[model samples]
Target: MGSSHSTPVAPVEFDHHLVSALADNAAIPVPSPARQSTIDAHIHARIQAELQRLREDEATVRDEMHAALEKENLDRERALAHDQDSAASSATLLADLDQVRAKVDRFHARRDLSQLPALREARDGLVVCYKNNTSTPLDCWQQVETFRASVSELEKQHIQSLQ
Candidate 1:
């Protein structure tokens, strides 16, 4: 806005002086070869040490993961074995319960039989008669003999079933 002319401006006098002085007397400092090699060796040693540490850390992590996987496999095997054992034990217990229930059912069924009821009533009546002395041994002998015969018949049936 101030000047529309395209002509170049004059250079500052101090810039010319500074450039001449640097050209005549300035010296750039460079590191010695021995010092630079020592620095390079130090950097290389640090890099190698860091790489070794990382490798060790990676190996440790791999070993830990392998051990964990082995443990998990072992635990899974133990759990499966335990489950199988539990299933076998449950089956055995169920079979035993079934046998016991069948025996109870058989006992209940036998109790309901007409012969068993009559035998029980006859034996109880004979006992009462004996306790009251209302009948002589000769008088109740027939009922006692009948009860004994019925029990002997039931025992024979049981023995035949076992055979």
Candidate 2:
């Protein structure tokens, strides 16, 4: 029941067509050309520096690997040389042993011949003792003389061989 009074609201005018046309022709925002070049230069410099560092690291690794390979080669050569030396020494020792064996065989043959004189003397003594009707012949006496002679010869030969 109060007097109904309504203030009139102003009507807002919008240019829909103009807004639509601007939207249709709108350009995408971008950095300035100079700024873009500066950014590209910075990125290129960083990449170049990183590449140089990587190259340096690769060179160092290659050098270390080469040094290690050289050391391994040196070790292998040393081992080979040592093996060769050992083989040479072993061959010499074997040759010396063979020579000693040959000398021993010669000595044994000489000793066998040296005993023949004593054996002949003993046979003669035995015949005389049997003819005289004495006790058994002293075979050991001749054997002792022959053994001493052979031993003396062998000692001389052994000394010569040693010298």
Candidates in order have lDDT scores of 0.79, 0.74
Index of the highest-TM-score prediction: 1
Q: What is the lDDT of candidate 1?
A: 0.79
Task: Please provide, for model 1 over 21-66, each residue's C-alpha lDDT reduced to its tens digit, 9 standing for 90 to 100.
Answer: 8877656556799989999999999999999999999999999999
**RMSD, every candidate, angstroms:** 27.1, 26.7
Model 2 lDDT tens row, 4-74: 66667799876999888878778655779999999999999999999999999999999999999999999
- Model 2 TM-score on a 0 to 1 scale: 0.36
- Minimum summed lDDT over a 10-residue window in model 1 is located at 154-163
Clashes of each: 0, 0
Candidate 2 clashes between residue pairs 3 or more apart in a chain or in different chains: none
Top-scoring candidate (lDDT): 1
List residue ranges in candidate 1 displaced over 4 A: 1-28, 85-163
Kindly provide the TM-score of model 1 when superposed on the true structure, using C-alpha atoms.
0.37
